[model samples]
Target: MSDAREPVTGIEVPINLKYEFTAGAALARFLSSIREGRIVGQRCPGCSSVYVPPRGSCSRCGIATEEEVEVSDRGVIESFTIVHIPLPGNPVKPPFIAANILLDGTDMACLHLVSEVPTERVVVGMRVQAVWKPREEWGYTFENIAWFKPVEGA
Candidate 1:
């Protein structure tokens, strides 16, 4: 018998190959804060460390966390980077920004977007604030807050 193979079908599709955890009541409640237009962080009473994602425990303190703190939009840049590539499903363009935003009132750093300023001007210690989108576009992700911009008149 001959060993000829059959021809493959037509379309080559593009798909996002990554996924996330869809469980946990604590995580669900944390995500809901975005839709409510608020930045929620949980602090570890044992170590007094804060987490922006508001996890159920604190690694540094080795204890559970439940104190939910409403964080401010204003923060100083602890660290930052200029991304030359795009993440799958990323709404912004390449060579934009990806920064570790340390919220003003907490000892935590969360990754976030930086906008309204050229990449060349972003300094390590510059102050910035959340530039939120319209209420209609709020969601359960970081995109809920549009981006961080340089503090006005600074």
Candidate 2:
């Protein structure tokens, strides 16, 4: 018997998914602050750890975080990786710096793009600051900040 392969036809199904969830009380406040060009964190009364993008609850002590604290836009890059390949839906273009930054006076780090500096020059502990988009573009999202750039004299 001769081995013959059958061609398989692929069917593409388009699915449109739409759903929304309330960010809850804590996160809603955090998002609203972002829309207003402010960075806020909640401090845990138990451990005194501040969380950017506040969760309203402390993972360490299992207690609710109540005190809202404004953090600096400038932060130190805790780690980073340069993307060399293009991927769909990537906000920043290829060959961009994606860094985990620990904001000043906060204990947690967040992931964001780093621009205005050479990728090769990106280093851990390097100070960076948010490069916000036009004020008109600020909405109920973090996209208001276009990307982060290294701070001068930092």
> Best-fitting candidate, measured by lDDT?
2
Q: What shift in Å separates residue 2 of candidate 2 from its native position after superposition?
A: 13
Minimal lDDT window, size 10, model 2: 2-11
Instruction: Compose the digit string of candidate 1's lDDT tens values, residues 1-154.
Output: 8768887778779875677768455566677987898878888889888788777888887788888888898898889989898777777788988899898888878888898999999999999999988999888877888889999997
Off by over 4 Å in 2: 1-18
- Evaluate residue 117 in candidate 1 and report its C-alpha lDDT on the 0 to 100 scale: 95
Residue 121 local lDDT, model 2? 87
Q: Distance from true position, residue 116, model 1, in Å?
A: 0.6
- Among these predicted structures, which one has the highest TM-score? 2
Per-prediction TM-score to the true structure, in the order listed:
0.82, 0.86
RMSD of each: 4.4, 3.4
Residue 143, candidate 1: Cα error in Å is: 1.2
Q: Give the runs in model 1 whose Cα sits over 4 Å from its true position.
A: 1-20
- lDDT string for model 2 (1-154, tens) is 8658776678788777889888977788889999999987899999999998898999999999989999998899999999999976675678988889999999999888899998778999999999999998899887788899999987
Write down the lDDT that model 1 would get: 0.84
